[model samples]
Target: MRYRPVAFGLAVAALAAVSLTTPAQAKPAASSTTMANTTSAGTTATRVVTAAIPFGQNGDIPVARNYSGDSRYEIAVFRPSNGTWYIRGVGAYKFGQNGDIPVPADFTGDGRAELALFRPSNGYWYVRGVGQFTWGQAGDVPVPANYIGDSRAEAAVFRPSTGKWWIRGTAAIAWGRSGDIPVPADYLGDSHADLGVFRPATAQWWVRGAATIAWGVNGDIPVPANWVGTAKADLAIFRPSTGAWNLRGTSPVTWGTNGDRPQPGNYAGDTGTDQVVWRPSNGTWYLRYRVPITPPPPPPPNCDPSYPTVCIPPPPPDLNCGDITYRNFKVIGTDPHHFDSDHDGIGCES
Candidate 1:
């Protein structure tokens, strides 16, 4: 997954990580308090405040955000069961910089996605399973997808400055022209995700998969999901000010309000992605589902009896003091000791 950078002034940097453990326990059903509003058209819109990223195979959505007003970063997994969303496996990374985007992918083909970030301060990309790599290009937006035919996803980015797409998977490919705001999906229906970009100035989407054509107008953000139930990804755009969504093969509908972030995912394992929005103002997530999703079976208890009072901690960040080599580990915690050594604000350089 990829994200647009947020503009904000920075303070001094620090790195820290927190680990927790807990005892085994039965999972609770997922439930949420929903507020429903009837539109003029008589359609009832249900809004649930859930702060999470897109859902993965395990019904877990990994969310990352800057820790308060400090340089630390926090990442956690949100699991939806029964009718409630549970936040678990929380971890923190110490060396997050302003304008950094946390991108999670299964770079090692481990069946689990690892969290990474694009640190603007060093002009490099960092992946938990794959360490730091030089992405000296300008407009380095972290765009993760399966550009290769492999089943695993890769750490990729679209460089608007050069209109090029770069993927660091089993192999590296740099192609395409200058493009803005990448919208990756299975555009070709080939099972492998393809790359697309939306030019906000012209409100057009340039897709490069089954066919290359420009579509849409006056779009601000790209919302990709399996709207047609064809198992292939489709495109949509959200007009933030108006809270209207223009789906390529569907009529326009209003779902969110201003200041809501688009986060589309297949939260129910239905193979169909659902539209989601995260409003930072209240840290709530709103989801709109086209089809009813059957909740997944609960996972087995993983609590450690010996450490009943200890909280289960998520994986640690991949950091090597003085070694610039890219190590595969999730980025979390603060670097108060300057473990990022060179003081470039990026912890493990090599």
Candidate 2:
């Protein structure tokens, strides 16, 4: 059975307006907008671009296209400390003309999600924290997932040309008979995102995880959410024709109008996914959840206080005459000591 969580209080408002800057001025900086504490039921929402990046520290940053009619885009980061969102950075983009939106994921395994955009000019995918790499294939749909059980998420794409899904995470490729909609989710609660696709023709969602099956129908714009409170991501769809959201185990929600984009996230920090819609008509964001809550940042990684680097055995000492066991504890650098059995400079003679 599909799991559905209890619906929290719903609040909706328009976010604060952000000033636009040129690409040269788009460095990461503190926001200049004034912050105010929002009430439980009423909070001003900020207008943002269609793409959002989860800050990993419990808040999300929204990106917006240049309102000045330039090719540059502005990114507004939500400051949990002040309960306000502000413009954080700006950059020129090629996606605006190509109709591609930026893809956000934790590609560096740092818990903080980064932004990535596909460059139609070079046929390469450019990731924010990571560098640009060749994807070769052409597709607009991008699925950010951790298909290899690693903490780092990889960018996956669905190529409608071949009706196949190519995952850059494990370099694993799979084929599906139909569907070009990209759905990256942790359908098994495994802490790793899996590959999924939605066939709008049949309104069926197919997941490649513990529970792989065809479910739902006539679903467009697949939105993954923990609506059932299972701690596992489930599928939700926005029917543009009716502006209704059909979430599993819950009644249909008449929320957005046509041309609105659905962005599902844990905006409330309740561990259950909530709904946020971006209406292009007014460039305003509409949220359907309780008062926004920012989760505490995760504890720092375990590192040697002095070195400030991950602790590991130092390199082994170079030796020619004794059993390797004797040099087990000896380290020359950060690696365990190595023995030169052949009297050559190279360690381990290999």
Question: Looking at candidate 1, what is the lDDT of residue 114?
Answer: 54
lDDT of 2 by residue, 82-103 (tens): 3233443432222112323455
Give the candidate number with the greatest TM-score: 1
Q: What TM-score does each of the candidates earn?
A: 0.56, 0.55
- Give stretches of model 1 more than 4 Å off: 1-95, 169-179, 212-214, 290-350
lDDT of 1 at 67: 24
**Predicted candidate 1: what Cα RMSD to the true structure?**
26.0
State how far residue 37 of model 2 sits from its true place (Å). 25
Question: How many residue pairs clash per model?
Answer: 44, 21
Each prediction's whole-model lDDT (CA): 0.53, 0.51
Candidate 2 overall Cα lDDT vs. reference? 0.51
Whole-model lDDT for model 1 versus the true structure?
0.53
- Kindly list the per-residue Cα lDDT of model 1 for residues 1-350, writing each as its tens digit: 24333223222122233322323322323345343433334544343323333222243344532222122222343322221112233443333344565565566665555555566666666654345665545457777777776876666767766777777634444444564678888877887887777776676666774455455556468777666457677777777988888778667877788877666665434444555666655445566654333456998665323223322222244323433333322233444324445545443444
lDDT for position 38 in model 2 = 38
